[model samples]
Target: MAERRVFITGTAGFIGFHLARLLLAEGFRVHGYDGMTDYYDVRLKQRRHAMLAQSESFTATEARLEDMDTLQRTVEAFRPDIIVHLAAQAGVRYSLEQPRTYIEANIVGTFNVMECARAVPVQHLLMASTSSVYGANEEMPFRETDKADTPLTIYAASKKATEAMGHSYAHIYGLPTTLFRFFTVYGPWGRPDMALFKFTRGILEGTPIDIYNHGDMWRDFTYVDDLVRGIRLLIDAVPPLPEARGGSVPGANVPGDSLSPAAPFRIVNIGNSDRVRLLDFVDAIEAEIGRKAIRNYLPMQAGDVPATWADASLIHALTGFRPATPFREGVARFVAWYRDYYGR
Candidate 1:
């Protein structure tokens, strides 16, 4: 296939930065959009954008997703073959403090993205969802088809709302859409608020690191590179409309595939599919830092799930790829990057 022009939002963010880098490396002309929010540290986001700017194929726009005019203009000007919408007000706990931001960013912002895609009619419109959507779901390994109606936080609810909105647009406008539910994503350039990053920082600084749920939580910790690889593969596996699939959604017979029957859309899980204990993850970081962390065990915060494990079979079936990075190895890589980046 020839190199395609792609538009990716949140290119300055963690996952977005990694995905854009991977796409650029594969010779794709990428137009990146990010708000450069000061949610954690603007320097980290800026650093990511600067690195991407070094690539000739990367063109970035610093703007918020809530700004419909700017987003629409960027998308119209780029005229991208594929659109990856990853920007959002992310964080389960943070959502509790500011629910309105979730509504504005994830809902209104996602609506604008959908509108742009509808106008331009890209070949594939892929957006990021979260495993938190499976709130209150006790299923060991969460599947795409699982009922995710019980969202515990506004953050998850907003993402779920976006999924519904995307489906409606696909059903009405014939837009080929895919929503990938991400598990606990971690690695180099990860968010400072995430457990892995915080743990690494605290361990190196000899500070106390909070261990939520008494270090009993479990997460399907997906490495950034592995997650990006799964995404790259899925870009080519665009969903087909029901008419094109012989009057039914393709992969209905497939056990884990969540191909929608009414439209050319699907929900795939992009995760490691292996749950790692929170304490074990901390242990990995401590080992890498060569010091035991001052652990501060705490009760589970509101809207927090005890564990999350992805049923990744659907993505593997669709793209012949799966995120298989082990927690220890991925943590070590992140620690190495952390030390080098901070001059520790």
Candidate 2:
């Protein structure tokens, strides 16, 4: 039997790298698409791609999502059965400083991806969304049914725009699409800009880590492995417009509107379902590193949310799996990997 082929963007990113690696291990031919931008640390991204390059089944294309010609050619050449879009301008704080970066990367880039998918139809198209879309939403456990309009950052706004763009594409092109909104994802080979990696790096270097929001923020930190597992399971759970809608209007994959009475589109959450306080997450890292962090508490930055909790019941209902990695174990594994990776 021939192996399945997957075309994934952001293959050099933390989540993309992990997902591509897992697919390769399962005997899937993986084609990774990345711009390899200097958003954070290009060296770190290159290191991740280097690891994936070791896999015989992995092939990477260096192209920005804004480059539609390259993106279209890469997608056509790969002829992927599944297209997972994960690349984006990520960073809430950075978005405040460079909002245009978010527009080009998240909005325009996503538009190109959808256009490519339209050109070459795939079995399933899964794009990454963020819990930040919840914005100022105070819903304890955010659901797929929640209205995610009040995005706090340009980053979130761009992502929310992509969700809308994807829905329109799905409706017009009859595409089978799934949008997975992820909570605060962290683990081995994580992004340095994220809280976990920053806190770990600072604590180990004896530098005071910036504790934002006066260490009062809450995050549903989902481990990368668990997140990829959720994505893996969701591969088969394509969105189908409910039969009861009379099949009048074509289905759309909009986050708040699963209006396809006929089209295949859905939104799902991939998270741990447990919100951890910022201080508690720091403590977990401290326990693993055997060091205490000198915290510099500060006010919440603009475009930042106070807390995030995911209601992953829909994902559990669909995949019969939830991110089960305990916070302590997950933090320990990340710290251990961090120590070894950096030779600390």
Candidate 3:
């Protein structure tokens, strides 16, 4: 559509880095904003940014989302027509240790982004949410309409708040916003805190990989490329106004899969929809490395869910595509990239 200018937060982060590169490759001028926090490895984030910097259409600004003044200046300078809010204090386990970090980065930080979007007004505003919000729910597949009242961790709670805040802003200002709830996203350039990355690192280092819940956990692992493709398709699928605000008749009683029906805002799960066991995931990595992992089976960690399965029917209905990358292929690609990147 008209050479769109895209502004994204957390470019140094895994999904953000991949999304930035994807957009740049598609001829979109990309503006990356990141705080470069030392939560994991600053060098890794910098490396992701460095790679994006090679693209002529890519420009980056180092700024924290909590710093509204600086963020405002950066946003104004970029003048993005579409803004993706991916920067946040990530990690469910880390949230238990540092609750305030989640507040400042996710809650307050997201508010600042909404304020900016309120001022500039974009064609579509997309933000990241996690499947963790399904907290305490034992349902097979999570739907957006599911009651997300019970958040096990501060990180999930903050994201839930952001969704509510975004809905309010959209209702009041007529802003078209799309919320993407990602399920176990993994691939090259993935965050070090994620399971796949950790498992690979430990296996390569001859260290034991912690198998939580005795390796019974299941996840809808989505490859980075597939997740980004879903996003690219949704970039143009701006939320349509609900047909009936006051009353509903057809399909009103149906309840499953996450899709908002009230405002010009919706939440869709971008995932493979294939739930693979945790042990199987580790096995795939081990096979890719040609070495078995030293496993340390343990009880499930606090704020950790036993399983996550994405009902991506809405995503397919909207985008006409679903994440088709099998775990073996996606994991192998990550392992190859990981080995090359670490020179192992």
- How large an RMSD does model 2 have? 3.1
**lDDT for predicted candidate 2 compared with the true structure:** 0.88
The better-scoring model by TM-score among 1 and 3 is 1
C-alpha local distance difference test of each model: 0.92, 0.88, 0.88
Lowest lDDT block of 10, candidate 1: 246-255
List, residue by residue over 190-232, the lDDT tens digit for candidate 2: 9999989999999999999999889988889899999999998
Candidate 2 collision pairs: 239-264, 239-265, 251-260
Candidate 3, which segments miss by more than 4 Å at Cα?
242-261
Model 3, 149-188: lDDT tens per residue?
Answer: 8899999999999989989887887788889999989999
**Candidate 2 versus the native: TM-score?**
0.94
Candidate 1 structure quality by residue, lDDT tens digits, 66-132: 8889989899999999999999999999999999999999999999999999999899999999999
- For candidate 3, the 10 contiguous residues with the lowest summed lDDT are 245-254
